[model samples]
Target chain A: MEAPDSNIAIAAAGWHFLCERAEILVLRVSREGAILHANRHAVELTGIPLEGEPLEHIFLGFADGPVGRRLLDRTGETHLANIRTANGLPETLYFTALPAGDEMVLFGQTDAQEQVRLRKEVLALNHEMGNLSRELTQKNAELAWLNAQKTQFLGMATHDLRKPAGLILSYAEMLEEEASGTLREDHLHLLDTIRASAERMKRVIEDFLDVAMIESGKLNLDMGVAAIEELVKSPLLLVSKSASRRGVVVTTDLAPAGQRLRVDGQKLEQVITNLLSNAVEQSPDGATVQVGSRRHGDGIRFFVTDAGKGFSEEVRGRLFTAFAGTGGQKRDGERSIGLGLAISRRIVEAHGGTMMAESPPGKGATVGFILPAQCLAPMRSDEQNGGVR
Target chain B: MSEQPGSDPRVDSVYDRYLASLLEGERTECTSVVEGLRAGEVPLRSLYVDLFQRALYQVGDLWEQNRVSVATEHLATAITERMVALVEPGVFGGEARRRVIVVACVADEYHQLGGRMAADLFELHGWRAYFLGANTPHSSLLDLIEKTKPDLVGLSLSIYFNLPSLLAALDAVRAAHPDLPIIVGGQAFRWGGEESLRRYEGVTLVKTVDDLERIATGHGSP
Candidate 1:
């Protein structure tokens, strides 16, 4: 065959280059959102075919979201949406305007299935909302009822039982003290009985108190902004006495002078101090106590770890509870009102955060808490001046 | 995604001929956010954490099944963390109007995918989720319970055998918050764990998305 002109050969090669190098899904359409052209990939996806067909003719096979319809209505208005190929599969379609002189060339391609799945998710979310709303209402109701029961229970215990128990405990203690003077052998046994009964009454009253405070939502938080540096020092100093009493070496990992944290210095200090004391009480003398903090997420996380006997799953279940000490059994002076942790939790929560304990039997225990950095929403001028009267 | 344009009838590909090609292993759709996540520029909720519980786990499974290795899992985790970071800033602990609940596997319980999945689901559904990262101590959990007193307690157990211990923990919480709803989900429910969970009152079990919706409704799933 005679050699074709160099110009003709060059044009043919250029056309092939445009097809292979570019990722455009070219389509031809009329003014009415009908399909006029469908590129190779677009044709592969939709399963519909031929050189001439309206867009809507094939779209009926699949569902469409708001973004999809908008693409069809606006000629020059382009949209990025997921579209189903004829195979009924979804694609993250990137529809763009391919200006073609007199006619508009509709160029499109997909981003990925992940994008399309997300869109469908928005529609599916309606169902979840309904579920959440219902769950919220029901849970709220349950909580309200439980609170009421706790209130009633506490009232009876404090007024009807606690006073009478106090009377018994007082007399028992008095008799035991008075008997010391008699110093008689027979009387010694009687004094022991009285003291024992007095201790029993005290234990009952304490348990009721734990139940009362945790349920009634009456825990008080003495709030303040204590520098993290100063905060760690106070707790460490306070717990030193208790630590030495039990032979535990207490350590404080305070951030430098510049590392400050907002807390109700009094309450947060009490929480740490109690946790510190609890550590001493749990561990044998000479064990190590580790106190430290680091940036955990968008908040600050403080931890108190003790190298001690650790805790059983059973004892740990009641760890922070009143009279629910771990290890072998509940010991004297170590009897938790259980109120400490509950109270501490309330204070931390009031400051907007969470606290937790981690102890595996034989592995020791670690208590940690995370508090969010302070927010900067300005209160209304009047609201700040006085409690909204 | 809106409906796709049909094939041009002029071309052919084997994938176009079969519907099964698109249906298998399909996952939660999240794009426009993947690039930033892969680049480590945004967190998962930002885009890295964007992979839903199922999608990311698949990446994990590929490694777990020995099809991939630790390096691949690490890459995926890095991508996930970055995505999570992207969205984490948007989620704040400042809001307390809605109870922010958290749940996790006990230290005795080894698997955590179930718990992580639950947390991811909660975040996607727009609830404040406190993910008690796995292997948490019972002491810490009890402390968390007292501290968070979340509206609901969601616990996940992957192995049926661990049901007894899971129930024990639930009982412990019951001692603290008798009214707090304890929701038990994950694989444990399938291994005839429903009967085990039911023995404890105030404890609800979920086996499906519908059950979860039931939980979201406030009836507390059963």
Candidate 2:
């Protein structure tokens, strides 16, 4: 005996359900355009007998676009077309035509208005996107212009401030010289204080200018090839007097000293001067500040180590920030301008180098920078001798 | 060294020594004089005005009186330029402000020492003062302004005849940057007087380095 829910029972039930409940117009037609049969819904909607009638009689026309051409050829594809209803009123329908056992089947629905509405919405969205793009471009231009203005104003103000400070320092120094023999010791002390204050102001002003230059992308590099030994020694000369005055001895350990690198000699000198001076300033009286350089794979690393109080982790976090000092007070007696490391880091990074600082509590601090060899490569044949390398 | 009634005797002697060296075309002597002045701790601005400016003025005056040839005058100016460079590093040290200012001589103006001094003053202050040299063409000057995008453009015209070029440059700069501040100076303004420059908008006349300092420190009224 066959089971009650067999495949044949399921197929008959599916066909019966489709013919009774499907909202689409389902019709059967011969290959020669003769109608064979029509579902109950199709006959009810068209109000015409479909069996044995020519398929063209009831449907006045079919669409001729891509979808309609598929339906005409009975290629089993869905199409959209305008068809005549029972009352001879025009209606848009999505029609699907298929072949079934020597007869053709067509399923159609009037859902063309929904597709039209969706297409209109997409066009509107595209228009809005175009407008938004134009607005973004306009805003970007305005931002660029405002940024330029800000840089200009700051540059002007910075330039105007320098000479007066220079002038004040000059007057103070002149007074110190002229009043030396005539003034009392206390009076001389006041003069010294004024000169020192003026000198400090000059230094701070210079630091501000440097920060501005680096930020504005206007720091010019005079790139040239020079002996690595000179690069290490020259900056020492600039700060030697200060170091000696502080009773801090600076020693150099330039391994592979004769190595040559392409760099901006003056800028590198400034970087070294800043770093060495800071090192010397941080070291205690009778302590040593060690500076060394060594070749690291396709690059050179330079370091400064001071035998003094190492900074706390808090200070190390902000060690390279402008105007940030060791817990707001320097360990050594030297006045901390605070911009040395900040400026030095910028200079190093601009030269395609990396700067870092490390201090393992009480072990003293080590600050170093690495200059990559790729950045130091000679740019052309002439630069090898003409300072272009 | 005879001490003047109201002047520092050391500054005067140093000034005299530099003047003699420049006139003699002794580059090494000029360098030595500057080094000595720096060693003695003489003021840089004082050296600029009392030595370089005064000496160049005397050279110009001598040329005017037919006591020195034009070539001698040119040599004196050139020596002063070199000396300015030589002494600059000693006088100016510190971090540079990121902002830029372009100092240019107005068209057809040959007196660049004044402008060079102004540039150095700016550099000393921490601004990257780009010295555009003497007699910069109007178009080139405008082009540089566009390229460098400086915060301020300083125009130096020492000859009265180049006043028109100065004005033209100011107009071009104004057109490009409607609100950019401009400072105008040079010997030309002394001859043309304030009346000629008073009509231009967004311009400041600086007669001394003090005025420049005031403007830089944001204390000047203009």
Interface RMSD of 2: 22.7
Which model scores highest in DockQ? 1
In the order shown, the candidates' DockQ scores are 0.02, 0.01
The C-alpha stretches of model 1 lying farther than 4 A from their native spots are: A1-143, A159-179, A183-215, A224-262, A285-302, A311-328, A331-339, A359-363, A371-389, B1-222
Q: In each prediction, how many residue pairs overlap at the backbone (N, C-alpha, C within less than 3 A)?
A: 63, 12
Candidate 2: which stretches are off by over 4 Å? A1-151, A312-317, A323-327, A331-337, A375-389, B1-222
Taking the tens digit of each residue's C-alpha lDDT, what string does model 2 give over A1-389?
Answer: 66877878987887787678877787777777776878877787777877887666655453443433347585666666665577667666777888788877777786757856765454435323432432344345446657656666756776788899899999989988887999999999998888887887787778778877876888888888777677877788888898888788999898665666778888888888888877876787878999988877878888899886878788888888776654244543546668878888888888899997888888788888999976554434545677632
Compared with the true structure, what per-residue lDDT tens digits does model 1 show for residues B132-218?
644556777789777776777788786677877787788777887788877877755655867766667788777765567556655
Worst 10 residues of 1 chain B by lDDT: B10-19
